[model samples]
Target: MPFYRFDHAPDPVEKAGFSPEEVPRAITAIGADLVAGMGLKEMGVHFHRKAQLIFTLRGIVRCEADDGVWIVPPRCAVWIPGGMPHSAALSGAVEIYCLFVDPDAAPALPAGCCTVAVSPLLEQLLRHAAHMPVMYDEDGPDGRIATVLLDQLARAPVEQLNFPMPQDPRLRRIAAALMADPADRATIEAWGKRMAAAPRTLTRALTRETGLSFGRWRQQLHILIALQRLDQGAAVQSVAQELGYESAGAFVTMFRKALGKPPARYLAERRRQDGNGAD
Candidate 1:
């Protein structure tokens, strides 16, 4: 697909006798308040001419890029490097924020796509920037805010929300099948038998390509799927059963071990961070 650049913010300086080019728009932002089933359900695979940061304060967005899937939960954002092909899926009620930055604006920021932790400070800055004029005074307060935002972005911590997909056709097929049917409780040997490969060969290929063992890789996918389902209001028991867990308690235990908290508390904390609820 052809690369596209979007200008969501328009410079009004030309009307004031000042050339629009005189202002340096290193960064620009767009915000939206979308209700359930009201906005884009998916952005088909495409590439952008500018680096992009997408986050939501009260909903979830699933992004696919860099041969991996990323979950953009509350208090987190997904960074897509310039010219990278990616797509996004959005649903439910969402208060989404997006930043389009000149690729050269921050050399220190991550060069690859990642899920980055969004600090409260950065979140507030994003909200502020989203409201500023497109061509605010470059030597004034707005300029300073843009500079600080870039600094904050460079310092943002990367989160472990990425579900890497292997490049091998066989492994890719397996990944797709698992995602399509996450409830499948098949063993390596069974999966291998279907692929016409030995269990050991399948395991080795997965580890070599994704830097994760077969079990770990599948678990990562499960965690990503579980987070999205839970965020969408699926009951814990329902989510566990959907994922083929024998019991809700088993699912909770696995979730706690993977994410450092149980499912309810985890989602609650995210809601609290988004100012939707109290601790």
Candidate 2:
């Protein structure tokens, strides 16, 4: 099934007796055991009411919020802000390792949810953390591991997969419509007529809400849809046609411009990177 909306799950922290503040050190201590216990199909959510860093050791996990959705593949992690309602859906089976960081450790990270590329050292550290017990003594190996994990987390590279929120109701309405059918080729005037707003008003809303013109926003939406499809193993040509592009060449051009690489190249690089690591 297509994942289009954010679904709330029951709070697992309360049941597990784990607080967000302690999740980082806790996970660093019990990293391996947690991965072995929670199979990929088992969905989990931590209301990390404190800014937290979650690492994905294997497989892909999809995160959805009111603003956008993120596909966190192997060797990539997500930084989720405290109190942001987000849920994850794992793809197939996964090792699913994670580390939660205390807010004080990384104050500069985004308060909202975003994905980051994990380094090989960080991946190894998190995998090692899975074996330790939660709340382990700070003086023990787990405590030392936790300290290194925090250092690595601070240096992880942030990927550009963010979709900012559209605050204007008028622009939001247009965004929702575009998301519903990414292939829509409606002109600004046509969309304005459908929304019962003047074309100028719609233009202003697009610029204000998303910092992108209608053309740019549409392109971004198309690229996002393409990424989702590619992750599912959709053929490039088929995906292009499905997205209303004239040809695969046209789609590749747009994707390269948006992501700085062609789809096949991007996939190959990610696959190669995954093969070399804990993923």
Candidate 3:
């Protein structure tokens, strides 16, 4: 419910005099206080530019950053690069834990935000780091956990779930319409008519702006919608119908072709991996 802001980097290093060993302890205290009054479901948006790793203990959270959008479900956390603008929206009540690390220590991490799967070992490590004093010795359990968290972060895999936007106004309008009704199933001619552009011109615009033909763009839109529904826990049959697929089988094929996995399997894997650490 309450949003707290921490700007550690701005404070003078000598006056603040916080030792690197105490980082985990400070992180733990912050995590405990954040969860004290609110469960996962009650957590609100908390944004910071400082490099940090956020792990979800339960529930899901949506994060939007400069690089792209991510769905952070339980056991998953998002690694945000220093200076990247990012924000979080709770998907449901969840126990969200975090570790703010010095960017210099994690050189293998991406320079931008990315979602990472958190292993069970990493989860416990984070919990341990949450309580260690801000100035504790680096040889302690807190320090070891910090070292492991950084290692897990380096080995984390990034998943892509972003749909790039077209900048051209003509293509943008058509894209907007498709997003508004993913089940429209309109041909290029029909969409061109609605947009007051010649079908040929519309096709060229789409190709130029998105590097995809009209049909491909529409298919991608459908896939995007299907993924959104799946993330929200919709059944494959229902999602297929909602997206105007002729049958669940057709939707499965499309999902498989686009993402290399069936809808159910993809969603299940996402849930399982996300519970471990996904963004």
Candidate 4:
């Protein structure tokens, strides 16, 4: 669903613990574990005064903001800047940690929505921060921990998990249709006919709005879906077939080409990292 209205309520920190602004500290970390079948599945469009880092050790969290959708897989976090309207959806069983930081607390952090790699130390910091008092002393050891957390977060390497969404209404329709049925292996010409536009016009408009060609953009969506599905424990063959790939090998080739690793290796590496620090 597209973001329509801005939600004027407390930030998501309230679900895990306390609200971010109620505390006098620069950051507030809270953790929540959501299992499948829970009544909660999506968060409405919302914005807050503090920036947020949505990190997950298990399952997946997808956030939409800044005209793009970002997926937080294992060992990564999606960073949403302060006052940027956004919404999030959770899949499967999710153990997520959200850290809300004052806008001015970390000058080095990215000022936009992006996914960043979470190191073992950074993951532990967030996990530990969740247990900290809402009003941690700025001059004490907890304060020092907060300083380290911010430092690590600032230096966290960004990942390429952002799927830019086109703003044009026609392009948005195409995007929505493709996301709804990823297995639809239609060409640009076919999509153009479906959208009542010339293939060249669709191509040019998509490239102009998203900086990616039609094929690349479609493949990007496939990659994002593949990542989310793999993270959810779907088998490679099933995921490949589900995405309309002729065979699992074809899907592996595409995944390896796009992500620099095959599905099994990529997921294994992430699970290794998680096992190293995950409780």
Q: Write the per-residue lDDT of candidate 2 for residues 1-279, one digit (tens) a residue.
A: 111101121445333444335444433322321333454553455365555555655445667664665656445677777677777766544545655556665676676677788877777776666545555677887787877777777677887564554777777777777767777888899988998999998888778766778888788767766766786688999999888888999999998988889999987887677667634
lDDT of 4 by residue, 186-279 (tens): 9999988998999999899889988998878989888988887888788999999888999999999999999999999998998888788766
**Native-to-model Cα distance after best TM-score fit, residue 107 in candidate 1, in Å:** 0.8
Candidate no. 2 TM-score: 0.75
lDDT of 3 by residue, 69-138 (tens): 4556333577777666667655444566667766567766787676676676676667666555556577
Over the stretch 1-279, how does candidate 1's per-residue lDDT look in tens digits?
211112344544422333212236888776777787776578899877778899787667888899898877667899999889999888778878888888777878888999888877888889888777766677999999999999999998898888898888888899889888999999899998999999999888888878898878988988988887888789999999989999999999999999999999998887676673221
Ranking by TM-score: 4, 1, 2, 3
Worst 10 residues of 2 by lDDT: 1-10
Q: By TM-score, who's the top model here? A: 4
Which pairs of residues collide in candidate 1?
Answer: none
Stretches > 4 Å off in candidate 3: 1-47, 54-60, 72-77, 127-137, 166-233, 267-279
Going through the candidates in order, what is the number of backbone clashes in each? 0, 8, 14, 0
Q: Alpha-carbon error at 254 in model 2, in Å?
A: 0.7
Stretches > 4 Å off in candidate 2: 1-47, 54-75, 85-98
Model 2's alpha-carbon lDDT is 0.66
Indicate whether candidate 1 or candidate 2 has the larger TM-score.
Answer: 1
